[model samples]
Target: MRFSHTGPAPARRDDWQTLKTLWPYVWAFRGRVTLAFACLLVAKLANVSTPIYLKDLIDGLGMPSTQLTVPLAALAGYGLARLMTGVFGELRDALFARVTQGSIQQVASRVFRHLLALSLRFHMGRRTGGLTRDIERGTKGIGFLLNFTVFNVLPTLLEIAMVTGVLLWRYDWIFAALTLATIAAYVLFTLKVTERRMVYRRTMNTLDSQANGKAIDALLNYETVKYFGNETYESRRYDHDMRGWVDSAVRNQVSLNLLNMGQGLIITIGMTALLWQSARGVVLGRMTVGDVVLVSAYLTQLYAPLNFLGFVYREIKHALADMERMFDLLGHHQEVADRPGATVLQADQASLSFDAVDFGYQADRQILHQVSFSVPAGGSLAVVGSSGAGKSTLSRLLFRFYDPTAGAVRINGRDIRDYTQDSVRAHIGIVPQDTVLFNDTIGYNIAYGRPGATQDEVIEAARAAHIHDFVASLPQGYDTPVGERGLKLSGGEKQRVAIARALLKSPPILVFDEATSALDTRTERAIQDQLDRIAQGRTTLIIAHRLSTIVHADHILVLEGGRVVEQGTHDALLARDGRYARMWELQQSRTAETP
Candidate 1:
């Protein structure tokens, strides 16, 4: 359930370290925690004393001469003790509620923020479904661990101590010794069995995540699944993981039964021994019936929590296991982080340059090689190349999604690394080749380009992208839900929405990576015109497969096998009859044969 990142392996955390990590978040509300503990102590005191009162009531009722008197004082004391235990226990929960929920919120928020801050490299390799499930389970574990550790585990231990002290003081060392021995045996057995069962629990978690991940991945690719008619295949794939999960879960339950049975047996043996000793003492005329009753009452009171304590320890271990993955995610070192005191990018008209840059998704497989290019402020540079020729890589470099492996990418004559990532991204707008939109209203998706955009601004950008008329025809218009990843819309429609989004952003630099590939011939022509208009007086970098689209660009660069083979104006490149000229001729012939 852990992910490998581009750094040293994440440190393995023990249960104590996991609990320690949670302390800071819970400690923020120290006053509430203190008050809750106070309530817990008072509640346990009342609970432990209740059995004492009950024993007195029973003994008083047994007295031959006093039987008719009704033992009113002892009865009232027993009732009041029970009432106080319930009241204070409820109060403890009420006081601790905010602390539990607030800690969950803070920890969840921290993990979420850390996920966002991680580099795209980490996310690209991550399984979204599994990652989300980890976060969900981890946050739930936080609440469980906090509530149970404080209320159940701590209170149980305290009650056991108090009960054992009472027995030793009022009765004999033998009673206390037997109580402690039984507790120790029960605890040792529970710990050993639960520790062995942890493998099954951890297996269940891994399989559950795998099953969920497979299910979500299949659903996200529903169109692809339908195209290949593989619905049954997907189901079987998911069930493969589920089958393992079921096995692990069954094993977990079986082990739990074993632990429970062992604990019960230990308690039963101890309780019988204590009661027998009490009865013997009474027979020897060394103890009264009330003393025997008191011993029985205390044993009952002590063992109940002891049983609960076993359950708490097992759950706490499970909680620690669940939280390990989430904290490990938080522990991942950010692959690309801004330097300390990095300044904001200050560019009125952004000019971009990649100088002698080399990069690869992996070090062994270079994607771009010694690539150098520049687009002056208010100029248009279009790159034409076949797929995987590093055309799109140029756009990624300018956006600083990945820093160049050699040399540097500069904005306004300064290394982009010198500026904060937020500011650098803020100055650039991109309409990516494959556009994915949020599952929300079209208006909302468009406004995501520049959040809090006014309705008028959104409308203006939509009109400029040539999607306004199409949207207006729908009954819901701007309010229409786009569905997951904008699947409700056609590919061309999604592309236009992307265009509208970038237009709304209105950054000084713009990148269009095969922006019009999704559009039909007629729509392509129209959208191209709009793109041309928007390119005016902005530094625009276009990665194009179509030579026709870049015919009017101020400069054209031809990339082949991750290298810049040719660069010049359109007329200049055609006259040279080089790589750019052959690509143009091939595309032109294909276009001519289209009709």
Candidate 2:
């Protein structure tokens, strides 16, 4: 089977747009940012002045031995300049550290929360491995972009300006003109080459995410792979993605080598031309020996960061690409949103109704057609149907996971859309057919029903679900770790844990979707008793595969092909001797054959 994200595509973004999106996060710490820049300015100024002092010291030492003074002041000034440069640069980094980390935290937090707020539809179609990889790379990119752009890129430009101005003031225009032209050419060349090379980087990132997604997907379904004896097949599938990644990475490295060679050549020629001019000036007696030393010193200072500038620019571009994908996640439209001024659902005992409801996961096929149903306050409704009869869709609609295509789902006589989603959900609890537990302690999963619930409350819930005795038999009991997706426990045990969680929630409304399908007949009967006792005076909706579980429900709905075919209590439906009777007879015959 092929895997792909079926969700809506993410929007494309430009580098400037991505940077603009990130600026506010960094700017929130403007005070620290301003201070860091102050330190940077001092450091760069001191660094530029170091060369001047060195030039003076060299020229002073050229005098005859008898006429020469110690020239201790120039030496000391040079030493102090170097020291200040080191001290303030370090101080700049220290001041800016919090801003960098803080912005990363804020952006990552926002992305995480927004993901949770997104509709279930979006998440259902997403790959967990690929999605998480995107987040990891995006946050890392933010740090690189901020540090390099501020410290390396900005500082390099400042130093270049200072060096060129000094060169023009002390020497002929030829020197300054050469420096400016070389810088302009180097920047232009780096930008053009890096732009072309970005395709390789993007391809590598895409293939890497795909490879990770496949590996994680296979690992999560390890049992299936073993049952089919397809370990080699899985490896080949993963290697397919890795093969693409390898090709892209090699191409990316090759392009990088080309860029480095071009940049090195530019630096070499510029250095040669500038020094030749200085040497000619000294030979012609138009300039002093110290002037050549000054020129060389300034060139050394300027070229160091200029070469680094090329590197910083390339990485910043890569960071922008990563951030663009992350920000696209932010830009994804929310499929379901609460209306402006939506009110809180305040009913203590909620009544649910689906009024002339019509819905489908896709427009091409309708799952339910004009279905209408209601469960009054403190009443219980059980719905039974064959597979693909739209039985589970009712619970999803009632919980407002998806709104009806043509009608309204109401709670307490008001449309659910008029209330906040959180408020509406807070009033209901559910035990899903497929119970998935977190990779945490059993106690933690139980307490998740009502966060901050005391240990006693957790134990009481487990006892109610009839799983307490089994749990007590374990070496670690409530603290026992449930491995990934609760695979360490049997299906029945996981179901019992889910039932206990729902019981702990104690909401006014409850939904049990095939809640006891995994349990044995004896355990099912025992848990069913507890369910009936707790469901008293609460509105409950049960979607069941076992007819025996819903025999005592106050009202029963029989659905076939997404339409309600019959509705009545257990005795009344049996008396009708139609669809419900036949289903009951079939289940009874199957149970008898088990012995």
Off by over 4 Å in 1: 1-13, 64-76
lDDT of model 1 at position 223? 88
lDDT of 1 by residue, 1-595 (tens): 3232122223345877787888999999999999999999999998888878887787777777844578788899889989999999999999999999999999999999988888888999888998999999999999889989888889888988999888887877998999899989998998899888887877788888778887898899998999999998889778877888898899999889988999999989999999999999999988888888888778777788778888898998888889987777888988888989899987779888889999999989998889888889999999988788998888777767788899899888899999999999999999999999999999999999999999999999999999999999999999999999999999999999999999999999999999999999899999999999998999999999988899999989898999999999999999999999999899899998997
TM-score of 2: 0.97
The local lDDT score (0 to 100) that residue 196 gets in candidate 1 is: 88
Q: After superposition, how far is residue 559 of candidate 2 from its true place, in Å?
A: 1.5
Q: Which residue pairs in candidate 2 collide?
A: none
> Which regions of candidate 2 fall more than 4 Å away from where they truly are?
1-12
- Model 2: weakest 10-residue lDDT segment is 4-13
Clashes of each: 0, 0
Clashing pairs in 1: none
Models 1 onward score TM values of 0.95, 0.97
